[model samples]
Target: MSAGANWAGSHTYSAPAFVEPTSVDELQQIVASTDHVRALGSRHSFNDLADTPGTLIGTSKLPHSVEVIDEDTIAVAPWMKYGEIASALKPLGLALHNLASLPHISVAGAIATGTHGSGDRNSNLANAVAGLTFITADGSIRELQPVDDEFDGAVVSIGALGVLTSVSLDVEPAFEVRQDLWEGLSWDALLANLDTVTAAAYSVSVFTTWVGESAGTVWLKQTVPGRVRGELFDATRAAVDLHPLPEIDASPTTQQRGVPGLWSDRLPHFRMEFTPSNGEEIQTEYLVPRVNAVAALTAVRSLADRIEPLLLISELRTMQADSLWLSGAYDTDCLNIHFTWKRMPAEVAAILPTIEELLLPLGARPHWGKWFAAGHASLKPLYPRFDDFRALALEWDPTGKFRNEYLARTLDLS
Candidate 1:
């Protein structure tokens, strides 16, 4: 781990080397020649999800382009960051339905891991992907659209299926958004009117310090023509712009004060120009069915003493369900309960099991890119289509060329 670790420096890859293929043909050749390889995204992952014991084919080098094929769709290169795609879409007066909290992650990487943004009505990032073009294990190019039977299993592949080359996403006419921050929400009040709080804005996030019965802040990103409810049960609008993470500068955050701006500008919490979060933190998130969100939060907050010491902050966001097989929100609405902990890996690891013990029983599934102790054996039943997804993985990567230790340990793969 001394070299080639993840962004948080939490997990070092076992990759013997790295490759940067600038074209589709080159990516295909690299995969076809290698017996075991994995596609490396922006290295934003906190765990060994992207690590491999073989060569790592870095997708950041495989060319770059964005195509607005029609008013409803746009195709983007795998390496293009979400911010870049949003910038490209802005000029065309187009946008996607949602975006993750940070705009720095690559489109392909985020989609592969089921990354999502906050919105009671929004789906995870992969939901916008209408078509995909990937180089299969055998160097064969396969293009799949939403209509195809295989499309659902491929969206949240977790870099398992193959090296994704390009993705076609559904887009819409550009719209405006406004951000407003509120402070001091009693935990009891929020849990009681959870529905009301979530519906307060187009995209809402509740941040907690895990110290008191009160959550520290609630961020509301409202769409144009959308209502701005700055005052919740016991919370008031922030007089000044605020950062979700306490004691940090808010300049890196997207504009606040409910100033209406482009969707690309306000959907994500952090601006693309600056780094998101502290970059010194390790994240762990769980997606539980929305029905159990309150109970799940209660369970984690019950262990506040253990979390506060190693915690930077915690965020709660909602996402509408989709049919994507591997999606944490599949067939049921979800609450993305995220924790950004201090760089204390050992302590964090020790505390996760207790947290999992509570939430897993509530149907919590860990975020693929974050640090989690749960393995396939414990997590399989959560996804009704887990075995189906496994079958699809084996079908596409017959020789296990795309299999890595993370998948082996988490998917029960040999």
Candidate 2:
């Protein structure tokens, strides 16, 4: 048996047998013979969802295939990395509607935890899923579609229901995106202009240090017609290159053809490529009602006096509501606020409660896979269909074979 740790190095567990199953049949055999079984991806989760006391099955060896079913759709394996999928789709003139900061997260892992990116007009990664294929506890491979009542509950199952093997996603023709970076705007200016700024681009994000005034790195992504040819866009690109948000270094690499590969390969919150100070760093992200974004950001900025020096970076982003159960975007437009602290877990732990207290009034929902103080009780109100999802989980894994301490505590699964 082998033990593995997650990205944050916060959780680890022992498995009597650690198996890498390259095929579905092998996975089924392992699960059928083991008392407790859990499927693991890239081990990117900060939480303990992937930890199991029995057999740990790593799906990294699973085959990843992308097939163009139609001009607007594609079928992909759950093991596929976001960047690999993007590269495959690019030649076909297709693209995902939204992508998490990093492209390295596995399809199943991202969908399991409801990962997302910034854009008031965009939705969670699971929202793009039109169908899913999984091996249920009974060893039957079932396919689900949007029309099924279980659709909403199954998309973001948190790896509790069963092992998801593949997914069918809705896609669009490939489009050219121009990323622009700038800074030097006040919190108020950003809040006031967020809607406009996001609308001007396909996606947008503001990166600032939690302390002091806003630093000069606001990243913007705008869809352009074909290849962008102009000095204006070039100048904006230059500005971004010159004064990158504090932590993100925009350098080319051989692995990703020179584009910032970090964004597509690391944990969602740790996706930025720029290397900041090498102190201990911890992260917490909150998603609140879109309408309250400006107000909520203002509230955090007001507490900047207490937050700034201890912080490394604060990111502001947005996404549309999604139907996936347990999704932060469940039934509400979301404004994401992320904070990175300078290697002081104790100080971060101390101030987090205060930050949550300030944003809770705005209906903040913590990211399931990130650090937060909220438990199942706090999760209920945020996810209206919480009970329904629990019921679905019970139906899928009645024997409690996939149950773990993290799943039990977070989902209140018996």
lDDT of 2 by residue, 1-414 (tens): 576666556556666678898887888787777778888877666657787767888888877799988887899988887878877886676788878776667888989888888777789898989899988877778899999989989998888888887799999866555555555655555655667655655566777775555433556665554233232221133333422226445452112111332223311322334322232456678998888888888888778888887877777788898778788888899889987666566787788779888887788988777777777886677788999998998998898888887777877986
Candidate 2 off by > 4 Å: 14-16, 226-248, 252-280
Residues 18-66, model 1: lDDT tens digits: 8877888888899889998898888898988887777887776667899
The Cα error of candidate 2 at residue 379, in Å, is 1.3
Q: Which residue pairs clash in candidate 1?
A: none
Error of 1 at 199 (Å): 0.7
lDDT of candidate model 2 versus the reference: 0.73
Cα RMSD (Å) per model?
Answer: 1.3, 4.3
- For model 1, the local distance difference test gives 0.89
* Poorest stretch of ten by lDDT in candidate 2: 253-262
Question: In candidate 1, how many clashes are counted?
Answer: 0
